[model samples]
Target: MSAAIPPADESLYAPLQAAAWRLGHLGQSLDGFIGTAGGRADAINGPENLDHLHRLRALADAVVVGAGTVVADDPRLTVRRVAGDNPVRVVVDPRGALLPDHRVFQDGAAPTLQASLEPGPAPGRAERLVVARRDGALALDDLFAQLAARGLRRIFVEGGGQTVSRCLAAGLLDRLQLCLAPLLLGGGRRGLAVPEAASMAEALRAPCRTYAMGADVLFDFDLSV
Candidate 1:
């Protein structure tokens, strides 16, 4: 049986009202793939789910994405689908893979912060935030502390799998919202690439709630619980 769709409003994001929180979101197919083999992931979810993403951006003090997402999508990361101020845009590019011409760096729609381990000139008007490397990856805890020092407490980790997965594994995400679309890509990129569990007993579990968003089903997991 199909689940009842909830009303589209601010109430849908009420859980984010906590004083300090980090939220990670991913939209994947029914088969647990976020994109196809060719790296096409545009519009995987329905319009309502897209609006939900924008709502998340609206509520957050900063919206973060990995360099891979910027290289692939070049999103502006603005709050256009809903009525709210655009949050500060943050790009995690530890390898310096992205060029300065990306939309997020060039658009100037909102303040942009490029977090990286390398020291270089920031593209366009984006500011450079030097981060440390731990175990060959950017230290997410250092990044979070820096962000908090900058008065960005409400964080939204909107991503292309690797970034979200790293945050999830590091115990940085307070909540995770996984939206599942009806379509299934037989073979493609997987979502939430966390470390393999030895058995079902070792699998990560959390208290969750469900909401229907148009044709997609949103799974809201409270990992902090």
Candidate 2:
């Protein structure tokens, strides 16, 4: 069944309207694992939560993911489960290891942008965006600036753990939506890896709200505020 996200206050998204707003989304188990040790994420989220992801993709100007996620999931990254147009797909692949056969490159449902550290030709219908490196890694700030130059303002960072962690660490994430399933994966990849705080006061806190997407619980945090 399909589910609707609770209506957000207009002010909450006002900052996004002016420029590129990056939002991160993750679906994890009760124990806070996005994938199993074997790197499988097919059954992490239920139908409703899956629908919610599609809704997010539909709403955003671009859907971004890491190269590892594409290699692991081979997702189409389209708005197939929801009612809306597909957003552009942005892949952060510093090594240029992603193959042209990946579904996102072949589907052609949306424009694909590939960010690589070295200058090279992108396969399939994807456009190669050469990003500057800071200490031998793609500079996240430059990547966002390039996307903004293309007029892709609202971006959805849906990814593997490492990519999400990078965004959170860099303070590039303006909003976060974590949907928790009722299952527990004892050991696996974490959803987000922010720095640990010494005390509760030092912990990262943001204005948060919750909603029910069928059996799953969605926690919405407004980091932009």
> How many clashing pairs per prediction, in order?
0, 0
lDDT of each: 0.87, 0.83
Q: What pairs collide in candidate 2? A: none
Tens-place lDDT per residue, model 1, 103-175, is 9999899999999998988888899999989999999999999999999999999998999999998999999
On a 0 to 100 scale, what is the lDDT of residue 46 in model 2?
A: 83
What candidate 1 gets wrong by more than 4 Å, as runs, is: 1-11
Candidate 2 structure quality by residue, lDDT tens digits, 1-225: 222333553343344454457899889999999998767697888897887788777778899999988988998898877677888999999988888999888878889989999888896899989999987778888998888888887889998888988888888888988889999899988888888899999999999877777788988888988
Worst 10-residue stretch by lDDT in candidate 1? Answer: 1-10
